[model samples]
Target: MRLAVLKERRPAETRVAATPETVKKYKALGLAVAVEAGAGLKAGVTDAAFAEAGAEVAPDAKAALDGADIVLKVRAPLAAGEGEVDELAMLPRGALLLGQLGTEHAGAFAERGVDAGSMELLPRITRAQSMDILSSQANLAGYRAVVEAAAAFDRGFPMLMTAAGTVPAANVFVMGAGVAGLQAIATARRLGGRVSATDVRPAAKEEIKSLGAAFIGHEDEESRAAQTAGGYAKPMSAAFLAKQAEVVADAIKKFDIVVCTALVQGRKAPTLVSQPMVESMKPGSVIVDLAADAGGNCAMTKPGEMVTTPNGVRVLGYTNWPGRIPAASSALYARNLLTFLTTFWDKEAGAPKLPPEDEIVRGVMLTRGGQVVHPSLQQQAKAA
Candidate 1:
């Protein structure tokens, strides 16, 4: 089987689809891997690195994607990057393409005579953990969110006593407390910031406290059982939101750095930080909204923009925080995709899996056989 990696098409998307190390893995699995020239350049992986990994290099996107059994990319195909991708108009015909599909581009590949897989459709299961792209990317995003927040803030993360006087540690408040939120807590604490975290899921309290960050809670019965079977936080009732907001509003005043990472699995992120709430924050404080790609946790945020509210607090809506660190991001993402291809392998025959449902396939199967198969995405599309 042949696999191809093309230059990422999304605007400002610097991440590559595969790393040299993973390309070697593909070779070991009896699959040939090809990359477009300079595909890994932005991620700091030189052409020589991929060449050294025993993979062929194509001079352009068309040559790379042509007749390949599988095509890998960071984002779905867009018309702007269509110069080399043939038959993209037939993407939905269920042939072979895989990527992260946003709300507007979900069924794209099927329309272009290609079968497409969206990593966002990965099912929550013990076996699929290695292939969970969201967790891997979110971990990096959570780590980067802290660095960005610190940069945007007026004060430093850690407290200090200069020769002049003592400077108190900055208070960092993290909302959501999911994988990304927990990581934010740990990273902030490591930087010596005073951190506190909150979530509707009562189960996250210990996870927060375990990292030495305070857990802000209303402690109601509903809050106690906020987790769904898949371990994601179920959206709260409007009544619950009202009460939670009051508690969170009071908690916000004391924090200098606010990082919001809450996201519903397949829906727009819930609005947690309101405009009035942002207005009450202290001047020179900063907010990093990781959920900006969906909607945003902070009301004052606009994706990809940096703006200061009337109160002088900075609200950052960074839609693609992980893209900023394309090197590590692409490496981890490539590993995730590689693992997905390993399940149907016939070790003796040395072939990549074809009949997907091979555990990893079950995890990320979106539309299969010309139908939208993932229940979550189906629900979302139906509602829309």
Candidate 2:
């Protein structure tokens, strides 16, 4: 079987799906790996590195994808009129496509007879931990958010005991306690900032405390059931959101740095930081909105850009935090793709064999056999 890796054409996307290390692993499994030239350049991997690792450095996407059985990507391929190259048109029929492709192109993939596996939809099962792309990418994003906040903030993070004067530690507040939010808390704490976090999920309280950060949230019956069976956050009711907002508004005024990572599965991110809240913050305060791509948890956020509030609060809404640290993100992401492929590989066939009855396969597979097979996507299509 042959595996193809193409350059990510999505704006602000610096991550590459396959790395030299993963290319070596695919070659060991008797699979031919073809990577487009310069595909890994943004992630610090050169064509020479891929070639040395036993991968064919194809001249372009067309060459890389030629007769490929499987295709790996950081994002979904661009459809006709979406980019300079119609990548979807170039895909070979019956190719197995895998990436963080959103549900937007499920019907197109089905029409083209391609099997599209959206890795972000992977089930949160113990056996699939290594293959979880969302967790791997979010972990890096969480760490990067704190780093960005520190750089944007005027004051230092740590409490400095100087001969001149004593500098108090910055108060960092993380809105959410999921994989990303928890990492933000830990990173902020490691940088000598006093961290606190909030979440709609009741269980996140223990997680926040474990990381030496204060937990702030209004927990009730609704909040207790805020987490889904798959470990994703559920959208809170309007009543619960109101109460949570009240608490957050009071707490955020004193926060020197705020990192917003709250997001509900398949829903717009709930606004945790209001415009009034931004006005309440002191001058030089920095807010990093990690959910910018999902409409942001801060009302002041402008996705893909940074804006300073009238009161001098800086709202950083730069999208694609994982892409900001492409080298590390690509390394982790490549391993995730490699792990998923190996788990479903058919040793005798020397190719992947996704069983129809397999939970992991069913969870990630969006389209197959000329149809959108995933129940969620089917419902989404019906609603649309």
Candidate 3:
């Protein structure tokens, strides 16, 4: 069996699926590895580095994917009209496709006769911790969000005393206390900022306080059940959201930096910061919206761009926060993919053997046998 790593064709995608470190591991599994030239360049891996790891470096996607039995990528392969090269069409039939392919591409993958495994759908179980790409990537994005916020803010993060005067610490407020939100709180605190965070989940209060950040949210009956069984945030009721917003609005006026990381799995991110709330904020404040790609938590946010309000408030809606720090992101992401593959490796066959009944395999497998087989996607299709 051969595994091919293709260069990401999605615009603004800087991370690659495979790194030289993982390439060598894949080879040890008795599977040949082929990497497209310059595939890992954005993530600081060179063709020579891959070659030194005992992998073949092909000049293009066509040559790399030729006769490949498995394909790894950062994003889904683009269709004929989506990119300069038709990566989807180039893939050999019956090949196993694995990546962060979004839910939108299920039909395409089914039609292509490719068995697709979307790492984003990896179950949040103890055994699958090492293979959870969402956790790994979001952890990086969370740390980067604070760094970007600090850079854009005109004031210092920590309070400093000099002979001239005292510089007060910036007030950082993080919305949501998930993996990304907690990391943002920790990063902000490390930068010497006074941080506070809120989450719909009742359990998040302790997590936020443990990180030395104040917790602020409206808690009630709805809040008690605000988490899904998979440990993801559940969408709150309109009444609950309104009350939560009121509390956040009051706190945000005094906040110098606001990091929005709230996201409901399989749904659009809930709006936490409205335009009126943005206007209430002081001049020269900054907001970093991590949920920009799935619509924004802030009304003023413009995905992939920064907007400055007339009052001098800066709203950053940068998409692909993980891609902003490609080197670190790719390293963690590649390890996640390697971990997943090795966990299900069949030594006798010298290839991966995913049992259909396995929880992890069933959780990530979106399509098989030329059909969208995942139960979640199947239900979604029926509703549509």
What would the per-residue lDDT of candidate 1 be over residues 1-384, giving only the tens digit for each residue? Answer: 778888876677888879999999889887888888999999999889999998889897777766687788888766635644543552334346767764355465434546567886777889878988899999999999999999999887898989999889999999988888988999999999999999888778888999999888677888878888889988888999999899999989888999999998878999999998898889999999999998999988999998999889999997788898899999999988888767556787665445654555655666566666555678877899
- Candidate 3, which segments miss by more than 4 Å at Cα? none
TM-score of each: 0.92, 0.98, 0.99
RMSD of 2: 1.0
The residue-level lDDT of candidate 2 at 144 comes to 97
RMSD of each: 2.6, 1.0, 0.9
If both were scored by TM-score, which would come out higher, candidate 1 or candidate 3? 3
State the lDDT of candidate 3 residue by residue for 265-316, as single tens digits. Answer: 9888888999999999999999999999999999999999999998889999
Enumerate clash totals for all models, in the order shown: 18, 0, 0
Candidate 2 colliding pairs: none
* lDDT for predicted candidate 2 compared with the true structure: 0.94
Against the reference, the lDDT scores of all candidates come to: 0.82, 0.94, 0.93
Question: 303, model 2: CA deviation in Å?
Answer: 0.3
